[model samples]
Target: MNASPKPPALTTSRAAAVWSLIGLVLLTLNLRAAITGISPVLGELRDAFGLSGVGVSVLTTLPVLSLGLFASLAPVLARRLGTEVAIAGALVLITAGILLRVVPYAPALYAGTVLAGAGIAMGNVLTPAVIKRAFPRRVGSLTGVAMMLMAVSGAVAAGLAVPLDHAGGWRLALAVWAVPSLVAALVWGPLAIRGRRAAAEPTSRPDARGGTGRADGSLLRSPLAWCVTAFMGLASLMFYVLMSWLPEIMRDAGHAPATAGMMVSIMMFVGIPLGYLVPVLAARLRDQRVVVAGIGAVMAVGLGGLLVAPSAGWVWAVTLGIGIGSAFPLAYTLLSLRSPGPSVAARLSGMAQTGGYLLAGFGPLAAGVLHSATGGWDVSLGLLLALLVPEIAFGLLAARPTYIRLGPAPLVEAKEIVVPEPARAR
Candidate 1:
């Protein structure tokens, strides 16, 4: 019998490409649904699970902590399993975690959150790196589209979770989210096999910034790198903390629960358009300074309005929505823009995300703890303002046109690459 030719390694079929895109969208949608969805129902979940304030905070903290912990390891996992397998596996974990809430026990509920967070962590870190590998030519536009979908999905889940809970019980509400997670896993599974085939095909590997390698400490030591990291982290810190606490803040200002939740949804909804818009816009601009300044000013205006006039809160909410939506996409764009190429992009993305997320992990908890200690919302909001200054300063630096230089500069023309919001390693 003739020996069978060795199966081609990592060759993606045309079918795999189409399915991978679908899998990407679905996976993006799954990332925030559980946590953002839970925020709207936190009061209910706290009561149902018999959680104290710390316990309630833990519910939110566990996911972020897990995200920070696991995100650091994503590159290694992708190397071992290939991106498709890692992502597909993440979807399975996410599905299991989302369904865990249905068990009617605190341990199960928290355990589910932990597992789900780990899934999200892997997806969050790996997706951008995968995108860097998959779509080197159009990172910005693609990142924009994926992030837009991420926002839309997150908004839908957060907006509807309460209604769903009211209509069918929290167990049903939490469990129902499992449907999408499982579907994503199924969609990605075949594509993953195909993806492995594509990987096996010999293609000239791109340069270091684009190639798969662990980023050096030299890149880590650069000021530009720190700027990217701080910009991403502070932006996320604001984004996540606002998502977690904004509804409650608005409610304290006298808006009804529905209205308060809707405000948060609106903020996220606006983010979808900006997710697409910001990167596209930023890519065309020579310097991102103007974009950064504009977004920072807008955010300041929105926050100022909210602080000054609690009665006209919805207007400020809209303003905040626009500001945040715009700024967030720009932050993601910088990951690719500042990197010399794909490898650096991935490494930078990883560094920025890992560090940024560690800082961001503190946001919700800090806001909640401060609120509890001060017995008011003002102090908490004030702390956010304190943070805004550094966010803007670093954003200005990151927005400048530059890339991290490795050892000796090759005598090659520099090429610009656009990164997307969801594509940010974090």
Candidate 2:
């Protein structure tokens, strides 16, 4: 009797997709854990390390700086190593960095921070690309899930930092995060090997399924690219600035350290739902200008509240959380939506993150410095408000339904978009 054979390829693919989704979510969960834990215990670390104002600024700036500096290398890595392998490599960096930071050496702290942040840089740039490639039809929903998970991770890290520190000093609190990164890296190991095999196979196409084959596009030359970069940069600048200094602002306003840290957690908690919904909403829209304008307005109100009345800090935190939560996800969604293919998506993600995070690095550093000088948060908060004008303007420009002009190709659009005269040449 002949037995019917199960379709091995189909079964294997289904299994792989399930694993991909799991690995992707796990990776997103760890992205913010390493960084967000710091703000809760910033004062303790400062006192322990004898950090001066400049040292504090540098410490605060390290994450954003590493993200910016390492972002450009993402697409390059994708080009050299397979995307899966590159991401695997990123997780390795994150795990090692997390472990490194908790060592008794002083230099290990900054060095580890930079290393972890760099790994985050890679994750930030490629995560959207992976979604665009693996779940093309489900981009909106999957992105929502990923963003939601990322917010959840950040909130958890912030909320638990104090508790963890109380249980076992600051070192143990930071060291605990290494567990997630290590687990994620292990999960990625087989995926990376499988990816490499798929890339080498003659019948396999990397571009079709998260491989990093080159796509035809001169992304850097496009002005729309700059608009996307500017909007993302400014949005990130606002978010990181608040994340880095919001705790200090609250602490100085007479809130307890735990309470102040919880504000950061609250901000992230509010982000959880917004992170899920914003991408879903933005993805359904052909023109995102209204969404962009609305986010800016919300952020403005929050900042205004913070500046005028630090007494009601929780109110501002929730408000800021909604705006900040929506803004970054929107920026991330544009990276995938604006591109026609995975290759272009990865490239655009790299470009946006490199320029954007570099611009954002200045935010935390400047915020730290400004607070140090003025000895108050009003000036720093006000500057963030002023920056919103340009943020919204660029957001409007970027939200146009036009796809980035690729190489010498004429501008493409998801819908009919009239190319402005100034953008025609580029």
Candidate 3:
């Protein structure tokens, strides 16, 4: 007749929390390094391998596709192998993929890129779940930390890849990332083993359920979930389009090639601090719709500025960078805030990322087609501006203080439904 007592929250020791944070930072560092590192060295690769434009495009596109395709598999992996083990396994895949590229063949290079991208995809989906489970109370701050690290590492790789390639050839440039991937795996290995051993133990509570709750496939039908997906997809689409063409846009505005490249660097640099600050601010707020709308406005203003005043590009770059940098972490934090528990967070994250990144893969190609068709940057940039309409609409919806309810509730009362312990801490 009485409801079952909810399980006490698992307590992580300060030392253990620090170590876990370290592992997370190290793992986040690898997520975008592989993709960005290759971009700066495409010339070297083309020269060495006699790659055509199509081949070069494939190399650039493979990782984005992998991010979407493999993200769907992360939840299945976490359900089966446990989250910690799945993450560790993903890191190992990344390490192997990075090392494989040093083999000096096109087959090996493409294979390594896909492998690495798949590994990064798993990491991308699971990292938010891990943050939700481990630091539920501090999701905003911690998500900011992780996202900042990811952005910084990516920028560093893009900057260093050319120098590293020059120093010891492209092989060394690609292979050097393997060291950090290996370190993250080693750091996370013990945690995964401990989780597996804990899970193997018999149930401490006789009536404890193994799952957080039944996922009624409601996420597939939920309007809120779609909004989240749209926000993620559109924001990513905008970011990637700019990443691919911002320098060219700058050059077209009468700036020299070197100045255009430097402006791109400035755009990225401006994001670093805003990436850390925005999520922390968003977390402290009750509803993030205002922040979300504000970001959209800033980005719109920046784009408008770019359209009107080509010489004041630095101002537009900084404004756009802050807008986009904040947008990503905002989307990530929404995954945790809008979910009741880590399991739902993982599912939502998987859904958002799979759909989001897939949409993102189209942005650059679409922009290119539009440019070629219209014979100018105006039409392509205008198309990007139009995308902001959907981005703002969905972002506002996703920012509301509401949890995603996927299906009908079980016969058990809400209080009687026990939230499952985190798999990582099991």
Candidate 4:
């Protein structure tokens, strides 16, 4: 008998992988782009829409809240519609939201923000899983790349906000970001189609790396999972809270609008380097507590400066940039580090981000309320300074070398954790 012809599936699989890789980077670039630029133009929005302090706060907080509200749906959509298709849907929402936000009506602005945020929420939860699935052995390095890209995009969006506002107005600045999402959505079109074909084959074995996308609730029992969730939540909360209010804080301290906007841009720019360093360094070390503690120390110094000498705003912005850059990527790495397989990673990623973002969503809102009530930023900054203590405690525990156990048995030691490779084409 003649040997069987080579399986066409292998060639098809490689093509899909390469395309999906491109799609992943494009998607990652948009994750923070929609959220970062708004602060720089908050004053304009307030004047345009007649937004009070509380309303401005609500505008900032709503995207994050939408992230929490819609994050849980990501895994479900991935499981049912296929991951690629689900991601495409997310990009569609983002594009729609960005376009809608630019409309002249105030309600359109609010609606668009929520829509864009929902897309970002799904991206946040699913990006880790896709990274896990595509490059299991290289999660740390790839995750660092993704975060670095995220930082770069965020920095550009913020840095250009004022200039763009000058060129065309806040509407043009906000509207331009939609182009990336629309392009990304179109790129994913082919991938989604391929995924649909693969999913249709009735006898398909569930990809051990979470291609099935089911995040069963088994994580609820693991204390380690909760620790990671809390760490991520608090870290994310600090990041969003500060990102939203820092420019305003600078303005309150008498910086020019352009200068104040640069503060947010500077913070994001600082993240560009740390975004790569943190995860790769965290992955190399057996324990990541030092890394977490070090990031916290940077945050403390930065926040302390902001609290005491709001006059020297630039120095603190760079310092906090160092803190925020490393802080978030390290927390994100935990989602991959703490789990055994891609599917488990996806589940944990989903769970952690949902709780984390919900907690973070409140930070901006609360800060706004306190600022509005007290007529100053002192109380807001003070609360953030106080919160760091618990944040550090949780970061240490979450950074320990332990794996989330999917079964009823106890948690596994660091050595027991396995980093399996993606299945090769036969």
TM-score of every prediction relative to native: 0.84, 0.87, 0.90, 0.86
TM-score of 1: 0.84
Clashes of each: 15, 2, 1, 0
Alpha-carbon error at 202 in model 1, in Å? 6.1
* Decreasing lDDT order of the candidates: 4, 2, 3, 1
Q: What ranges in model 3 sit over 4 Å off?
A: 1-12, 202-216, 409-426
For candidate 1, what is the lDDT? 0.78
Please report, as a residue range, the 10-residue window in candidate 4 with the lowest summed lDDT: 416-425
* Candidate closest to the true structure, highest TM-score: 3
Misplaced by over 4 Å in model 2 are: 1-6, 42-53, 203-214, 247-263, 308-312, 368-379, 415-426
For model 3, what is the C-alpha lDDT against the true structure?
0.83
Q: Candidate 3 clashing pairs?
A: 218-406
| Candidate 1 regions with alpha-carbon error over 4 angstroms | 1-16, 198-203, 207-219, 251-258, 372-375, 405-426
Write candidate 1's Cα lDDT for 1-426 as tens digits: 998754453343445556667777888889888777777688888888789988987887787777777776666666667778888999999999998877889999999998898888878767666666666555677677777877887778877988998999888778888999999999988878976886798875665345444354466557887898899999988888887789888889899999998887777777789888787777666588998989889888887777777678778878888888887678777876676655556566667778877888998888988899988788888878788899999999888877776545411223544444444567
Sum up the clashes in candidate 3. Answer: 1
Report per-prediction Cα RMSD to one decimal: 5.6, 5.8, 5.9, 4.0
lDDT of each: 0.78, 0.84, 0.83, 0.85
